[model samples]
Target chain A: MSRREQAKEENRARIRASAERIIRTEGIDKLTMRRLAEDAGVSLRTPYNLFGSKTDVLIALLEGAGFDPGDALALRDEQLVMEQLFATLDHIEAFFDSDEKFYREVYGGIMSSAHPDVRSTNVERVVAMCQELMTHAAAKNELQIDTNTRELGRYLGVQLLAVLGMWGAEFLSNQESIRQVRRAWCGILLQHCSNASHRAVDAAYQSVALTGS
Target chain B: MSRREQAKEENRARIRASAERIIRTEGIDKLTMRRLAEDAGVSLRTPYNLFGSKTDVLIALLEGAGFDPGDALALRDEQLVMEQLFATLDHIEAFFDSDEKFYREVYGGIMSSAHPDVRSTNVERVVAMCQELMTHAAAKNELQIDTNTRELGRYLGVQLLAVLGMWGAEFLSNQESIRQVRRAWCGILLQHCSNASHRAVDAAYQSVALTGS
Candidate 1:
């Protein structure tokens, strides 16, 4: 990369790291652009120039974290669909667990923000991740999605967002949240699974008997 | 009631009506305690004393809209589970359609607010409505949910929020949002329905063939 590009990339990384630190220690409400600039030792306008707003910084933090759905989706026959799906979710759970308050703040910001650009970008990322999983499942004949996979993927994607929202809001216990999500996801898969995949789906559903409400 | 209590109640009602008018005509972002008080011709402290926050006013508006889940749940086999469920949703859709922008703002406000009380109360209300439907379904033997009905109710409730969130964000068309919700809901009911209800669920699913994604 050119020197300018390299410098810009380094600046972004520095901003993101500082933002993450602020969000983790002081909470999302405390991490304004000015605060971020100060923490990162950059000019006041640097945060605005680099990332447009607090939500963008949060989104960048998410992107920087190793939660790539494409990587997760690439596992074709390496594992069962259920296993891979849960693993993908587990990856997300780990992210949330790492900094529960920060994740909640970012999610709440994404959902509640009036900014169209922020909402669209975040929703697109979620839909893409879900589409990756659903598309992979459809291609492998593990799930019997008869309709448009894109629609179904978006459906699943938004559902994940809702579950996380509830979890973040403290309306659902961790086990209950996981259980409810798994049931809904498995319910959809079970409805569409071929006889070949039926046994595997049921086995997977029963494997983790999350007992609490 | 005492005269003082009666006057206080009347003042609250007037304030709410004025707030609703501002929300519908000017948009939610236009709403402020001072604006509401001025519109209602009350003192500035009245709005705050009456409802505490803008979100509380929005919640009151929702409650006043005749969208009571208790009433819906009280229907003991007055209609099939699917019919009752859709009717309840239709009631909500009607509210959304009545003042699309206002409802979106209220929903966005509730979701995004950092106040735990607001989030908990709002989520509990949604969950209660869903649970009412699921509980009623189980009572009438219209559905055979294998897991905890409360959990399923919470699942469906949260999905409804997600769908509304996307709709407000303009990520999904109105028809697509409705279709997606009904499809996922019916998909779940189809899995759990008895043979007697299977035909009903399938018919309901096909009754509204929303074509676009």
Candidate 2:
């Protein structure tokens, strides 16, 4: 890579780190472009040029904070399709629980942003991750033949977002949020699973039900 | 009722009516307490005294717009449990579609409110409505004997809210939003349904899957 490109990457990373620090020390509301630029030791327009808007910066923060689907797939390579999906939920729970205040605030910023493109961009990323997994499961004959993997992925993606929304809204705790997503996953996948994979999915459902009570 | 009590009720109705008009004609952001007072011909403190906050006013607006769970139950008394649940989703879709701009703005207002109580109050009201229906389904042996109806209800309630969240966020169109919710409902209920209800639930699942594709 060229020196200029390397410098640009370094600047991006520094800005993101600065944004995270600001969120941690202050709050999402305080992490404006001017504030971020000053904290990161860059010009005022640097943040705007690097990131389109405040919403873009928050999306970058989320992506940097392990919101990438590719990373999620790589992290659970050893598990079965159903187990892998549950693991994804576990990963999300852990991520949110790791820093509840930070995530809640960041998520609030993203969801409440006036820019619809940013919201859909984030939702589509998660949906693609789910679709990739469902497509893999379908290739292995784990899911039912009639299952529209893409649609199911979209459904799961929206469900996960909803669960996260509930958590952000303080309607569900982190643990309960994961459990709720698990229950929905198991319940939805129960009908979509092939006979060969039904047992594992059912067991997961039973576990969620048992623990929920 | 005493004359004073009756007068207070009249003020509330008038204020709510004016609030809706402002939201419908202008937008949610323009329906402040002061503006509502002028529009409703009440004292500026009248809105505050009656509604507590702008969030409370939105909640009242939502309830007035047929968001009450009791009304949902009454609207589908003749349908079976499964049908009743689906009907409730349909009811929500119609309500939102009836005036997309108005409901979307109002929903955005409520969800983004600083007060968490109003959000939970709305969520709990929907959850209770779902639980009541699920309990009735269980009593009739329509659901599996060991199914946790309450948990299932909470799952469904949260799912519905998530779907609405997607709609409010403009991630899904109105029809697509309802389809997503129905698909989740059918998938989740497929496993918990009794033998007699299995065919019906499966049919619903197939319908959602087909429509979704």
Candidate 3:
């Protein structure tokens, strides 16, 4: 990149880092433009010029922190479906678990806006990303089945996001609870897969018999 | 049923009804003690005499509207696990869908507060109710088994709450999206129960073959 472009990118990163830091120490609600500017050693108008508003700053925080799964398509690069899914979710867990206050602020900021359009569209995009991830999974043996792929994709995607939000609401110190819940989830999915293993044989037999008859 | 006691009981019901009305109309945010008095045609001190603060009014609003699941014990009494689970979640669906304004006000109020402990505790209690409901389902043979009861309960409880909050957030609103996701969940949970159901047979087989050699 050119020197000017590089400088702009560096400035942008500094702003998001400052926002994250302010939220960690002072709470998301307390992250005023003035506070962020003073902390970042920039004029007050700099934050406004860079981020437009606190909510916009949050959008940047999510993006710059590499928590935006939107950026993950680049990582897909013919990766396994289940691997991609785990990578996406693990990134979220690690990102949020990095600091309780930062996660809390981002979540609150996402939902605090007066407009439903912003929140709704953002959710829609995330859900769509999950659907795409699951589709890739089904193509491989990661989630092999005859079930409706799109339907199942939406189901798992939405369920995980909701869990993330609820878990994210708790203090980062509540990692114990998050860990407990995650272990339970893995056990349930694995056990269920084992249980359904027999069903696959039964299903194949039934399909064959019906066709044979 | 003494005259004085009867009068007190009637007045209390009247005051509670007035609080509900205010919430239904103006929402929990505006349901102040003074507003309740004016709505109920009672004295200014009547609300304070009955309930101390705005939070108390919200607690009462939740109770008066029956979003209070009573407790885990009572909610677990339904016949089928899915039926019981849906019934309990239905209470929330009804509450938030009661009035767009009421739902937003209550949720935002609880989340935005400096003191989120009480509200967070209440959410935990609600989650516990789901766990209890799942356990009861297992006890009654409504849910099948392959996994341990605790993990199954946590999985169902935690995941369902995640979906519920998203529904509350209005992120999962498309009717098609809701129905499709719910169906996949039904399939997944039924698959879970089937596994849970077969564990006993496996344990029994471990003891000995019928040859008893």
Candidate 4:
């Protein structure tokens, strides 16, 4: 890489670290571009030049904190589609539990923000991830042949977003949030599961229902 | 009907009407207690005495605008449980559609507000309504014997709130929001349905899937 590129990368890293610190300690409301630039020892224009807006900065922070759809998709080969979906939920719960305060502050801020970009970025990523999973399941004949995997994925994505929103808003604990997601996802998948996959999905659904008690 | 009691009722109606006008013409943020009292031509203390807080005032406005669980419950005797559930969703969609601007402003404001009361009130009301419907379904052997209606109700409530939140935020069209809710609700209901109602629920599911195409 060029020296200039290396410097840019280092500067971006510094800014992200500063953002995390500010958001964690002071809350998202305090992490303005000016404050971030001053805290990161960069010019005011540096943040705007790099990230464009506060919403973009928050999105960057989220991505930097390991909010990757790739991680969820990686389980595709190792587990059944239903199990992989549940595992994805587990991963999300673990991600939030890893730093409850940080995730809550970032995610809650994005959820409540009037800026549509951040929320759409999050939703679109999840929808793509779900679509990929559903496509794989359909390939294996686990899902009905006629299933509109994209719409099904979109449905689940919105539901998952809601559960996460509740958790982000402190309405549900990490465990409860994950449990609800699992139960609801299992229930929805049960309706779409082909005969070959119905038992597996139903088993997961029963487990969620039992444990939820 | 003592005159004093009747006068208090009249005052509340006037204050509620004034709150609606302000919230409708201006945004929810502009409908402060002081502004409401001034607009209503009542003493400032009148609003405070009548409603505990701004959140309470918003809730009153919502209730006054036909946001009633009883409306959903009234369908119990006239229709099957699954149909009644979907009809309830229709009722909600119609309620929101009736005054898109007002509902959007009030619900969007409450959803984004840090105050927990408004969101919880909305969720709790839906949860109770769902539980009642599920109980009625179980009574007719439409649902599994051991289904936890309360938890199921809560799950559906959160999902509904999420869809409504998306609609209120303008991320979804009114028709699209209701369609998504109906589709997801059908899928979830299909899982808890017994042999007696599986065909009916699956039929509803198929209709939603077909129309969604």
- The 10 consecutive residues of candidate 1 chain A with the worst lDDT sum are A204-213
- The regions of model 1 sitting more than 4 angstroms off are A74-83, A132-136, A143-146, A168-170, A173-175, A207-213, B1-6, B143-147, B168-170, B207-213
Instruction: Residues A1-213, candidate 2: write the lDDT tens digits.
Output: 999989888889999999999999887778889999999999999888988899988878888877755576553555678778877777888888888878888887888788888788888988888888888888878898888889888888888887788787677888898887787777788878888778878888887772222
Name model 2 segments beyond 4 Å from true: A1-10, A74-79, A210-213, B1-10, B74-79, B210-213
Recovered native contacts in candidate 3, as a fraction?
0.17
Please write out the lDDT profile of model 4 over residues A158-213, one tens digit for every residue: 77887777777777777887887777677668767899788878877777772222
Residue range B1-213, candidate 1, lDDT tens digits:
999989889998998899788977887778888999999999999888888887787778777876555565456565777577776666666767786666666766666565678867766777787877777777777665464567567767766665665675566655566666776666566666666567777776675432233
Score residue A184 of candidate 3 by CA lDDT: 28
Q: What C-alpha lDDT, on a 0 to 100 scale, does residue A38 get in candidate 2?
A: 96
lDDT for B126 (candidate 3) = 54
Per-prediction TM-score, chain A only?
Answer: 0.82, 0.88, 0.65, 0.90
Predict model 3's lDDT versus the native: 0.56
Clashing pairs in 1: none
All candidates' lDDT scores? 0.70, 0.81, 0.56, 0.78
Judge candidate 4 at residue A141 and give its lDDT.
88
Rank all candidate structures by their lDDT, best first, as comma-separated numbers: 2, 4, 1, 3
Please name the candidate that would achieve the greatest DockQ relative to the true structure: 2
| Winner by lDDT | 2
Off by over 4 Å in 3: A1-14, A41-45, A73-78, A112-115, A137-147, A171-213, B1-49, B71-83, B87-114, B141-146, B174-188, B194-213
A79-149 per-residue lDDT for model 1 (tens digits): 76656777666676676778666666666655555567887776677778777776776677766546356
Question: Which residue runs of candidate 4 sit more than 4 Å off their true CA positions?
Answer: A1-7, A41-44, A74-80, A210-213, B1-11, B41-46, B210-213
